[model samples]
Target: MQPLSSVQYQFPLQSLNTFGIAAHAHAYLRVTNTEQLIGVYADAHWRALPRLVLGGGSNVLLTGDFSGLVLHLALEGKQVVGGNETHHFVRAAAGENWHAFVQWTLAQGLGGLENLSLIPGTVGASPIQNIGAYGLEIKDVLHCVTVFDPRDGITRTMNAAACGFAYRDSVFKREAGRDLVILDVTFALPRSWQPNLRYAELAQAVAEQGYAVPTAQQVADTVIAIRRRKLPDPAVIGNAGSFFKNPVVSRAQCAALLERFPALVHHAQPDGSEKLAAGWLIDQCGWKGRNLGAAGVYPKQALVLVNNGGATGAEVVALAQAIQADVMAKYGVALEAEPVFV
Candidate 1:
């Protein structure tokens, strides 16, 4: 096996993760190209160790130092892979910054990704969470994803249907995807664009701004403006955006909750389930702006859990547990965290 490139030992991770958790990987490797990835796999030393693929670090929390190999996918590039008169197909490397890629698509006059504007993390991480915002999710635009299988040391593409997408989840988040590493993703965007104004806040903003027929750019800008107001910038504060998944309940459960709190924020899913606003539940339980040790719920958005400087991962986990228990006890709804705790 050839010597692998960009390898390091005992890498500091505070700057890498958005939460600013001070943790270290036993060993780290940044694979810039497919060849480097292949070489790493060819080495028995690396092949035998457990591996974790890290992208932009926006959607993960470090519970403690990682004991195995951490592969930082630095591969980067994008291109118009294919297209039709009605749609355009574009492919982007896994390491591409998600927000920048969205902006780039907008610059190219592509329409599908606008609703997902300003989301943190990388293209690789998007599919795993089926990341969504302002009424649009990644599953809507994703055409296919390219993956590298460590077991076989081969690359392959899986179409959208094979992704097994659900709310904030996909096969990549489940057992089926453990052996696969995301390499790049292709998106199918409509050329004949229609802005998604299904989200209430975005719709109100666009209406108040007097955009009767909003263009793709206008919609993107509006969503960005709304997110800026509600979600804290990770750069200014240590946080993973939206710490909890909005719990989905049955219609009967929704009716029961409505009996007690008529003004509860919720949306009816097509499958007859109702999705509750996690932030609202947390706030109603009086956890907003509250802290357990060094971790605190963000005062502006109750869904976010923040590191109030020098906080440990255990503290964050404990704070999340407290919030979960309170919400469960009060509303009988379990608030599952969005970020993956490593």
Candidate 2:
């Protein structure tokens, strides 16, 4: 067993999380390999404590000091593992930066991940959140997930279907799979790639940039530019990108809302539902550029809640709740937060 003495107590986490909230964990371990995970799980004392599997810390809100063990996943590696007749298989260790991974794939001439460029977080967290942007989601390209089961102290692989991916959710986020820790992710990039410009804004941006037929690299560059313009860099301003999940409502509910809100922004889902833009709803409620304590809505984008400076987790929660209340009261649609509160 890995000695408990290796763990650091009262470890600072302000720098770990993108939100920049000042917080600490009772015990912290920097996991660089799967053996470390096995060792930790095998230790009875460590197993008894609550655990937080932390990656890039982009999708978490630290409500306060964590009274449990924080396993900081720092494992890193990525490569073009192999290729078949129709696709190229690329695998990345869980802790590799998400945006960097996308860029890396593009550098290797992979195209499928271009539309998901510039998303913040680690590749490991991608499946957990089913992170998406510009109409492309991780699930669209994910081949499989490798995980470590603490209960059995065994490492295993699960195909994409087994992950149970949905919009901003997966089996990993639910109670049944909470104890399974992601070790790495494999993506299957199509060989006969075509640009995905299904999203109107992305298509318009490409046209404006004079790329009648954008290459994968060009699409990634465009995506990076778009994200840079709207979202604040976490290093500059603390925030989790797209603080709320775009609520999915039935077609009838959307039609009634459209009647009441003439300019409501919504998109038709394949399942006959309507995905309402949470940012639009919040902006309509006049929450954009608004502040509640040190937590405030981003001036350029209402979907983002930023830490103006010295914001606490409680303060961010308060601001989020306020926006949710206003949006629900006005549109009768409940907005769910995308970030997990720790």
TM-score of each: 0.97, 0.98
Q: lDDT tens string, model 1, 1-342?
A: 654657888998888888888999988988778877788787998888777788988888999999878889888998888888888999999999999999998898888899999999999899999999988998999999999987789999999999999999999989888668899999999988898888888899999999999989999899889889988888988999999999999999999999999999999989999999999999999999998888899999999999888888899999999989999999999989998899
lDDT of 2: 0.94
Clashing pairs in 1: none
* Residue-pair clashes per candidate: 0, 0
Measured by lDDT, the strongest candidate is 2
Error of 1 at 323 (Å): 0.5
User: For candidate 2, which ten residues in a row score worst on lDDT?
Assistant: 1-10
TM value for model 1: 0.97
Note each model's CA RMSD in angstroms: 1.2, 0.9
lDDT of 1: 0.90
Off by over 4 Å in 1: 2-5
